[model samples]
Target: MSVVVAVKPSARKRNAKVGRLVAAEGTRHAFGSRAAAERWAESLSTGDGHVWIAAAHPADDDDVDCYLVSRATNAKLEAAYDKRRRRLRGGEGGKQQSLGGAE
Candidate 1:
């Protein structure tokens, strides 16, 4: 599932949030699963722990770009994943992109 979610307010607004922590800098993050996305969001908001963003599998990023996301976004998004997944599978909410590390 090549799902992308903003780890921060800016990323969410811009709709470009996804990728591994190593490349999440200015760039947004894309996750492989809702669980992973939620996990990262939780870590970024709650802990002083490091957060990991989802990057294109073969990581084309050169520097670490991950950022901490807000907790509010995480909880709301948990249900959103299910809805979006439906849309993605039905090809209604997306274009030619894959939703979960598929394409």
Candidate 2:
């Protein structure tokens, strides 16, 4: 089943969250019209579970071939990040540091 979802103009908050998950997976993403993005997003379902992101097909010739970052992946990444932040902070009131640091 192919479906299209319009892209809602995303702000830094939305984009930033997605970026990290795709990065964790060592993949690339495309940005463009929402309908295209949604189509790609919906294709990630597998027997195990839904994939978090579906990258644009390389065969695309359009000036802008949209890519999709799965909502599932986005949520997991955000949850993991939040947990790491809490762990690093060790307690409330301290500034959370980056996990990507010199590790």
Among these predictions, the greatest TM-score belongs to 1
lDDT of 1: 0.49
lDDT of each residue in 26-102, candidate 2, tens digit only? 34444354555554544433333333333346685533344343333466888888877876778455455567854
Measured against the true structure, the TM-scores of the candidates, in listed sequence, are 0.31, 0.23
True-vs-predicted CA distance for residue 103, candidate 2, Å: 53
- Name the best candidate (by lDDT): 1
Q: Clashes per prediction? A: 23, 1
